[model samples]
Target: MSLNTIDIVVFIAYVLGLIGVAIYVSREKAGHEKDANDYFLAGNSLPWWAVGASLIAANISAEQIIGMSGSGFKIGLAIASYEWMAAITLMIIGKYCLPIFLEKKIYTMPQFLEQRFDSRVRVTMAVFWLGVYVLVNLTAILWLGALAINTITGVDLMAGMIFLGLFSVAYSLYGGLKAVAFTDIIQVVLLIFGGLFLSYTALDLIGQGNGIVAGFAALTDQAPEKFDMILAKDHPHYIDLPGLSVLVGGMWIMNLSYWGFNQYIIQRTLAAKSLEEGQKGIAFAAFLKLLMPVIVVLPGIAAVILLPELERADQAYPQLMNLMPVGLKGLVFAALVAAIVSSLASMTNSIATIFTMDLYKSDAKPRSEQHYVTVGRIVSFSALVIAMLVAKPLLGQFDQAFQYIQEFTGFFTPGIVVLFISGMFWKKTTANAGLAAAIGSFVLSIVFKYAWPTLPFMDRVGIVFLSCLAIAVVVSLFENKVQDNAVDLDGVSFKTTAGFNVSTVAVIAILIAFYSAWW
Candidate 1:
């Protein structure tokens, strides 16, 4: 696609502005000697609003916006279960999960495991997280970002991949989490605006033939099959086993692991000024989650209704951009770029944190702040290059990049979730049990993913999590619980009960809404 003059101009100007944000943030971090906490956790000084915005931006990347909408086009609204299911997951984390981490003042999820179990468990979990962090999450994100940029700019995928990889790496390495958060606020705003504009234009196109409500009504009536949540065995439009399983079993595992234990998303919470801020920031993110269907998913349905015969699902989102007027196209294009960059910065910074804290200095006494920060930058750049290499192969397999990432997530997350949740409040969970649970669940999930192709994905995840929990519990009962001389739970408490109240409402509301919407 040849971008006109206005599109070219808007794209360049937006890239420049983000580069400027990166430069300013890098200077801020450079001014101080960044301690371990300062570099990894943003010095624990972020305000509630910035944390909230960063959380949303970090979580909603080009993959979710662009790739998820592509899923919507293929699978209809059932694809939206991922977003809605996350509301409940966030509430759980904000209540049961966040306070424990906050009170402990831990830098990474693995650090919590170490305190709750043993250093061996911590190190093992760290290796698991690092592998997923680099190979699955970061790689898929970079690939899709490059895909979106390539679609808009007429550049080759490799070239687009390299450009974005370098640009995000430069700032993320220099400034640490502080830079990521500040720039994320800007990225979120642009992404929302861009989505709104694209949705409006798509609606307008539908309006040209029929009024807004009528257009949607007409589309809905014409292909009721598209809106059906259940798949028939024979029909392409049917929500087959893969589709249904993803909704039922797959989403829960992904959301819980991601919100509860993943370092990147949870890092925003760690940066909050207080536990209250963190809880509130999470609530804000939940509210935003409700809007995702409007911004990303609904347009995809509309695209399918309008352009049903398109050869590929990945083409749906970019094709929607083409429907906009020239100037509006430029603006929407810029917004997509912002979403890509925001996600890149978050991942790059988080990868650096994991490497520096968990692996590089795992046993060493705390190093000087400057030394850690300098090392963080180098790690970020290295990760970016790795992601670029992975992008090409990933994009080739899945019609939409989002599903490709989710499929791989099944391999690691279920076990990690089982290990962390059990380890956190379950005192009887010994370090050996924690390790066994994680490794065992991972093995079970891999078995389901590859060995048993006939089984549904969600069934596999449920089985893996259950198997791990059972093993961990049984092993802990038989073996002596590894007692850490320094193990203490008091360090991780959030004295106020604000999260409980909010979480109660969120859980009930999500349950009612989820069942009611489909029922």
Candidate 2:
């Protein structure tokens, strides 16, 4: 669909504004002579509010907006399970996990492993995450975003892909985590507004006379098969076996490893000024997580009813956007850009952080802040180039994107999380045990993924995670305890006013439940 002049202008204006923010932030970073800690970790000074917004912005991107909506249109409301379950996972992290990281004062997830386990394990896991973060996760999103833009506009796919890569690279290279967090605040706002608009517009098209429940009923009647939650046992298209394997057996393992351990998400908690702030931020993100189904998933379901002849599920969001009146169309496009850029910037900054702290500064003589910042720019530029090249090959396929990127993360995350929990709480979990858990889990997941492709992706992840948990438990039990190096979690304060604000959480929870019921 070709956009009108106003739509084009609005898109250009929004992009320019983001570029301006990036340039302004870079100047600030330059002025305040910053250290590696300040550049890489945002000085551990981001308040709870910023942390909350940034986390949501980073987490909700083209994957959720484009990929998620596509899944919803094809599979019905079951896809919303991903967003809702995240709330429960965040609560677990805030209550049980944040205290340990805050107390230990670790920068990267790998660093935490080093202290809990050994250097060999830390390096192994570090290399693994670095590869996944850059190659699989970031690359897929970048390509998908470019594909959407190319489909919507007349721009060349390769050129659009390169342009986006450069834009994300420049800002992330210069502003570090501070820029990523601040800009993400704007992104989250735009994304929420854009999504609500699409939902409202779609419902309006269905007819202003009907309430949300009636609107959904109308859609379901028009396309009864799309609303089918249980894939027929004998149906060839039914993924019941895979779905059952993925949903029951694998999802928990994946979520636990991700929300519980991943560095990109956890880095926000690490940057918090205090444990209270971290917990507050996590809880806030949890509340926002509940809204995703309405904004991203419901719209997809609406698309199925509204445009029954549409060939591709991934085309749903853009097609809906094309139907919007002029002003609304621009805003939605801007929000999509915001979502994509926030994720890109977050990944770029994290890659630089891992390189600077985990790889560069660990052994080399400590360099000046200016020198480190220079290296950061070079590293970001280099990574962006690699991601861009990878994005070209990632276009068109949605199922492959999810499985290829997510399944492998399970192996390392479960093992790392198990070790971290044991390291903090149990006195018997030695460094050797942590190392063993990580190595064992990594090898086991690879075996599971290739050896048993029919076993459902999520179930395999669950098996690997559980296996790691068991190995960590057994190994830690047998390993010798450190005589004097044992960590003390006693001094860490959990009584602060940082716990989940029940009222706010309750409101968000109610809204999510109401929407799900209506759907």
User: On residues 1-519, what C-alpha lDDT tens digit does candidate 1 reach at each position?
Assistant: 767898778877887887788668646434556677767787898887788899889888778887888888887776776777787778778877888888788888877777777678777877877777787777777777776767666678888778777767655666778878888888888888989878766765766656567766665766565565444456453322245554566567778998889898999999899988888888777777777776887788888766788777876787788777787788888788777777888988888887787778734577767887788888888887887787667566778677667766766677788788777767777777778887887678777767887665656776787788899889888896555533355666545465657655866687567656553
Instruction: Report the lDDT tens digits of candidate 2 across residue range 5-123.
Output: 89889888888888778667645544577677677788888898888998898888777788778777777666666676677678778877788878888888888777766677677
RMSD of each: 2.8, 3.1
Give the CA lDDT, 0 to 100, for residue 315 in model 2.
70
TM-score of 2: 0.90
Angstrom error of the Cα, residue 320, model 1: value is 1.0
> What do the candidate models score in CA lDDT, each in turn?
0.75, 0.74
Pick the lDDT winner: 1
Q: What TM-score fits each model?
A: 0.92, 0.90
Clashing pairs in 1: 34-369, 103-491, 103-492, 104-492, 231-238, 231-239
After superposition, the stretches of candidate 2 with alpha carbons farther than 4 Å from their true spots are 24-31, 208-213, 223-249, 394-400, 449-452, 483-486, 496-519
